[model samples]
Target: MNRSHLGVLIRMVTWPKKVVFGAFLASVLTAILGILVPWVTKSMIDSFTSHIDVTKVFLLVGLFLINVILSGIAHYMISYLGEYTIYRLREKMWAHILRLPIDYFDNNSTGQTVSRLTDDVSTLNNFVSKKVPEFISQALLVVGSIVFLFVLDWKLTLALLVMAPILTVIIVPIGRRLYTVAGETQNEMAAFVGKLSNVLAEMRLVKSYSGEKKEYTRVMESGDSLFRLNLAVAKLQSIFSPLISGTIMLMVLVLLGYGGLRMADGSLTTGAFVAIIFYIIQAITPISSVASFFTEYKATSGATKRLYEIYSLSEEKVDELDEYTNIFDGQIRFHNVSFSYNKNSKVLQDISFTAQPNQITAIVGPSGAGKTTLFHLIERMYTFDNGSISCDQLQIDQIPLSNWRKMIGYVMQDSAIMNGTIRENILYGVDDADEESMVHYTKLANAHHFISSLPEGYDTVVGERGIKLSGGQKQRIAIARAFIMNPKILLLDEATANLDSESERFVQTALVNLMKNRTTLVIAHRLSTIRNADQIVFLDAGKVTGMGRHDELMNTHRKYADFVEGQNLKMAQ
Candidate 1:
């Protein structure tokens, strides 16, 4: 991650920073207190040989107990604070995710996003709560012990220093390799998670097509990849531990022999020999701990990079207009509008049409006729490349998208719903809808009867994406949602495509009523639905080939007449 990204995360998380800093500060103080215990033992040993001070020995023991108590308390608080910080950070990160643009979600996999939010965040939490405090403790202990060792006997400390350069050299290469492997493993894990999400989301489709074995194999492959990467990291650590232990053992052996000779020569005090052994043991802890700290530091940094990628997503543009004042007289104009999702192939080319105010305009053509693309452009879901889409003689690009969207009620081919009560889903777009207005729209959408018959009536939980409801029921609920929006313009892309004849007739009637006062635009494959439209525009290869009402188009346009004739014959059969 770049410094600016880390700085952004730090800024987002700095609200409870004082608690984190205090916890680290207390942990360092606790490590400092721990060093005093060995010094006290050395003092008690010397006093016993001379004056045999029992009271001083008892005082030293009590001091050691006090240090242990304080250290435990500080460690607990530090850990507690770190965990709490992570909790708050996850919530903050999730909120940031929600505000990000739709394109970000489109470009990324669901599994990868989930992995970053859950696994990567958890890894970062471990770094903050446990590793950070331990790092601080190790630093204080290492520095304090070194200073004391120099005071006791500078020559033995010098001897210990000889191994330091070699350890640093060993750690540098291994630490870098460990980080690289850890990052690869984490990325593999995320990819696995994403694949699982995709399979699970379409579990019904998989089962219907008997794809269980294929899915299982895919998941297993991902697991094997994760296992291999993890094994590589473990192999590095396997070597790392023994190398550090061997170096520490070598230093201890040398210190024991040299110190024994010093004691015999009377160059070092007997009490001081005890202290040096204790200091050497204490020093080993910080050395091993500091090594692990750097190792984890590299791993945590990898997690940080994953998290930063999410935080770095560009936020959606929200209009800064103070008043909801963008006027729309319900006329939509597409003037020489051209668009392509990618630069190579064009989806729509010079698409121009006008849906007059309070008119039911229909767009019809074969599959891939750029029917939906035209709707997307009108909705501003995707901006055009070469021309202007205007409303009431004002350019759409000049208006805030927030206000522009508020003027239209959109219903897609898929009846999109969420896990919520029936009433909640109905009132989703317009939260301030009164009960009478709610009932009126629901009745108009033909959803009121089925909803009232449910066990919980309007309060019935819809389950995830309305899975608890029948497909037809979900479509009615969606229609009611669009109805309640009270928008000046209504945009429907195959709203009745997925419904049975009875449900279709009911929804079509409700939709017809809903479109009465609004400027309605419909994209339909079946010619029957648009036969009564005020204007019908036939699109083929991203351009309008025919334009007129049902009778006029059938008489004048060959494509429109053939499409109507084809579907009419299918109905007869």
Candidate 2:
């Protein structure tokens, strides 16, 4: 287990001192009350040797009544403390995961990460709410019982003490192995969850391909792994009960037999022997708990390690040059820019270009030419390996990530709409947007008429990834979303590539409205749409091969001229 993560988890907790103190007080009082009972029973039984004092009998009944009352309060108070602690810990864990870099999500599946939050956290919560307070009182009870037994008959206490080492020898190795198995279980459970989520989320594709049986078999592989681990745990647990129970029975038999002989010889009083028996019964309950607690603690420690690892991850850092955050003339310049996901797979080379403020600058390239990647760099979704991308002469990386992203509105060719109402989708990021503004923007994007046609109108829920809406409707909804931002920069990545001609015309009109007075960067496959662009950048094999107006690129760059000629296109602008 990563001990450092344990420290980090502790610091993450938001402790409410009053509740903690109350819970602790209750637990201690309960343990003390528990200890007093056997002691009181001893007094009552010993009194039998004489007159059997009525007052002592009454005292035992009163103690039982008070114990019952305190037990109720203790259970509730301790549970409340545990629940509240887990709540705050989960809140911290959630916020941390959200703040982590996008790459974390890219590497980890939704199921895997969700497992960390839901399953692993629940394990830790079990330890906190149920195990910890239980262990505390159980430990106290066990210790108090042993002390009383020693005073009654030191020889019997020695026999019990001899059993301790033997039990330790039995339990320690089992605990270590259980810890290992438990950790394996957490990992297998995470993988199973990830696989299941992946299959369900894309069930349409599975049905389309007729791969239902194959997917099920794969999911079952993970399920089988989990089952095997569970079986291993059960086998280990099965060993525990019999070993501990046998040891306990052996102790009881010794007390009865040896203690009987001593009483017969008049060396031991009947009342003292009876009291010793009561103490043994009382002690056995907590002793069994102690053994199980070690087993449980080791198992829970596996989950603790997982919790620690998640919280230990480094979050995304943003350098907030506040002065430059909102300031933009939207002149984007790329100088000696180079980037790659890794060393071998270079996506963008030493690229340089500038998109002027309030002008539609188009980047035209074939597939795999890194056009979409350039847009990601400008949005600061990733850091460029070399060179600089800047807006109005200020390097983008120097600006805060949120602030930089806020300045631009990106509408992809296949823009995703979250599962929500049309109104919520349109105004997703704009918190303060009113209904009037949302409606106005929807009208500008040519989205309002269709939205109003629906029975629920703006209140209608767009199914997962906007499945309820057509390609054109989802596109226009995205446009309206961009309009709400009123951004200085707009990125349109083949925004009409997937739409029909009729849908394109409606979306084009909305795009025209959205593009007005914004610094626009467009990545397009068809050269004709961007023929009137203020500047045309031709990217080929991850390098800019052409830069200038369409007419000029046709005259100077061979590839650009060949592309235009290949399309049998007329030269414009």
* Alpha carbon lDDT of each predicted model: 0.81, 0.82
The lDDT of model 2 is 0.82
lDDT of 1: 0.81
lDDT, candidate 2, 490-519, per-residue tens = 998767666667667776787777777789
- As a whole number from 0 to 100, the lDDT of residue 516 in candidate 1 is 71
How far residue 418's Cα lies from its native spot in candidate 1, in Å, is 1.6
Please give the distance, in angstroms, between residue 191's alpha carbon in candidate 2 and its true position after superposition: 1.5
Supply candidate 2's per-residue lDDT for 18.
Answer: 85
Maximum-TM-score candidate: 2
List of clashing residue pairs for candidate 2: none
Top lDDT: which candidate number?
2
